[model samples]
Target: MSDIFEYAPAPESRDVVDIRPSYGLFVNGEWIDSLGDERHKTLNPATEEALAEFSYATPADVDRAVDAARKAYDSVWGRMPGRERAKYLFRIARIVQERARELAVLESLDNGKPIRESRDVDLPLVAAHFFYYAGWADKLRHAGLGEDPRPLGVAAQIIPWNFPLLMLAWKIAPALACGNTVVLKPAETTPLTALAFAEICRQADLPPGVVNIVTGAGETGQALAGHEGVDKVAFTGSTEVGRLIARSVAGTRKKLTLELGGKAANIVFDDAALDQAVEGIVNGIFFNQGHVCCAGSRLLVQESVEDELLAALKRRLATLRLGDPLDKNTDIGAVNSAAQLDRIRELSDAGEAEGAQRWSPPCALPDKGFWFPPTLFTGVAQSHRIAREEIFGPVLSVLTFRTPAEAVEKANNTPYGLSAGVWTEKGSRILWMADRLRAGVVWANTFNKFDPTSPFGGYKESGYGREGGRHGLEAYLDV
Candidate 1:
């Protein structure tokens, strides 16, 4: 589905089209400079360069975006027939596929995720999200939730920097398909793809103010969540911030959904295929530089084969290529930003300081980029800082379990119950562990499996609400 002429210059070209961090608020289908006093630089995590400058939306601007979304929700989007709405989503999906290459490249260059992942995981899931939700536009009556689950009016959504477009799609597709207009704020580290999506909305001839995107930091996000005009608030990020958002929306009429952080446990039983277990462990926490809400950051290995598995994991990690996200061969890219790199460093240091045996694969990381060697800390006790806290980087905390009961207890020990992996050949053990693990997603053999038709979310401190599948529509509905 790709061609030689699909992109600018050849694949070897370094300097691609520059989309400076846009300094404006997308409101009423137009991009206008924010009436704010401050601006921020969105950095290229790979090169540690300020790739673009962005304007911080003041509380007033957030109100304006909410007003615009409210106006569109009541006047246009809300009134549009389900079939007509479906057409717009279909158009957007087509445009995303047509320009998939550019989006894939832009996402990689901004978020510092491998281009292969952006192309494969992020982009396809984004497209499929739209495609899956689009069909439901006219089929809401048969959704099984109610006679008709109507829109929740205007939604204020805050997405993380890791999977910019994919996260955006997860929020917006369902909101729009269910007839809700949105005011979205992407993370300061990676706002490019979301801004690009605004252009895609325009290309799709989507109704004005139906999907407004505002780019900024925490203050902007706080303004969006606390604003009186928003009918719903949904966020995907840290549990700390999620708690603040929850507090802000406490007494309000607004519906809320939070897809916060995770410290998932990937448990490998003695019966697990050794090679496959190694691959699952590597992919679990190392992918996307481990900037995942449901990342398997904790490894719970059966004591019998713990040494063998750890050896293989370390060796496999060493072979991973770390470099430019744009490079096809770069298996692991830099962290999303310098701050994130610092956090990873700080956490890694804490692991060592706390007396855990920390090990980083002896891979040469690029000096210019915000890179951290894929790190693993063994002998990690549940009480250790590295084992308990969410490092949110390419860092894995390894712990051992002597029995099945101990494994389940350790796996479910964290406040996060977002996801957990069980690698085993035995069907009985797979189902047994799946039943015991208090995770929203139980990856029996695979590590990170996602689809638009599959439900995803977290429990406990990891936050609440489902993001995908037929059930995802609940968050946007009046029911």
Candidate 2:
């Protein structure tokens, strides 16, 4: 493929980011060593290169961070005028915009996502989230929740590695905007950007302890989520983990919100614009190496057009460039971690064992790094694990339906219902489908589209509570 075009590698220069050799927990607006000596190395999935080492947050360290947040809330952040808090948030948003390129490069380096997506999609949304929530800071009384919504103090937020910086923004911006302080733990695999965000808080002159960053894995998140001082817990990851956190916080007064896993369905009707629908299908599943919680991992096409759509979709998959997260032209980058890649392979193999036909384009992958070729499984039954479970990779399972009612039934059959997409030219049909889908978000002709002002979450085992929009404010509020 390279010989055909003689394409040169256009790797984004990592010189844009200055990652520290090691990092400590950010507590009370200062960097301090962990109480324990245990440390873990954060690696780049693209090359398995050690990017940085970060100390794990011990239970004591989590307590210190939570205490700091609580102290800040009681002494300063809670008493701070909404207008003043808005100014701080606005400054952070402006700084994020100014350093967009740096954050994008760092995000790609740390998380193994294409620089194009990090630069164009994640960074922009992160800044916009802050800007959007900044406006809401001073206007909560008019947000329809109550006459005067009050902040839930000392929120503890645990985010996933898939969209490290963007998830940070999603968790932090609204929590801060509602006049609450936060103790946030970035996923152990992708903590660089969050540490960099601590720098942003310092640049904005945010009050000490107003925002703290703890870098660690599941144990650290467990400690933070179960801490008694924390008033609220917001988590984004797997539903299994969400259940554990829910149990840990049970019988407590702690308010909780979860944005967990999904196995979204992208439906293509015979009347849809075939070419655009194919594009949506590709973007929905292959974007971010299919690491999205709301990724359209399943394709439910009207039976009349299944063959045509599958042929067109395979052709589109052939054109996807997979390699080098720093490359400007790469479409699919490395999977986030070795564990995630193995999970994808296991589920894809199960798809084959369960009698589904699997296919991939004749594209060569890099000898090094964690990568999975864009794949699609046809003749997938609802009983197939590939169709029922979240693969979280660049894989799609295709199924067919005979009627709108059948499509609705098939799409809603999953245990997860975070998001769904329907492609059709008929406006009435689109509305009808949207009204019947049991998901938080429905895209009529588009797929994987997001906005800072729009609420996004899930139903059923996909977890509860919404993030973004006016509804997002309620999660951190005590009306």
The best candidate by lDDT is: 2
lDDT of candidate 2 over 261-331, digit per residue (tens): 99999999999999999999999999999999999999999999988988898888988899999999999
Q: What local lDDT score does residue 352 receive in model 1, on the 0 to 100 scale?
A: 91
Error of 1 at 470 (Å): 0.7
User: Who wins the TM-score comparison?
Assistant: 2
TM-scores of the candidates are: 0.96, 0.99
RMSD of 2: 1.3
**Deviation in Å, model 2, residue 374 alpha carbon:** 0.3
Off by over 4 Å in 1: 1-22
Residue lDDT tens for model 1, 1-479: 66533223223233544575445778889989889768877777888777777788888888888888988988999999999999999999999998788889888888889888988888888899999999999998888988967899999999998789999999999999999999999988888888889989999988899999988899899989988888899999999999999998998899999999889999998988999888888788889999887788999999999989988988899788778788777778888877888998998998999889988877787779888888898888899988888999999999999888899999999888899999888899889988998888999888998999999998898888999999899999986
| Superposed Cα deviation of residue 38, candidate 2 (Å) | 0.6
Error of 1 at 355 (Å): 1.5
Looking at model 1, the pairs that clash are 21-52
Note the residue pairs that clash in candidate 2. Answer: none
Q: What's the CA error at residue 133 for candidate 1, in Å?
A: 0.2
Q: Single out the weakest 10-residue window by summed lDDT for candidate 2.
A: 1-10
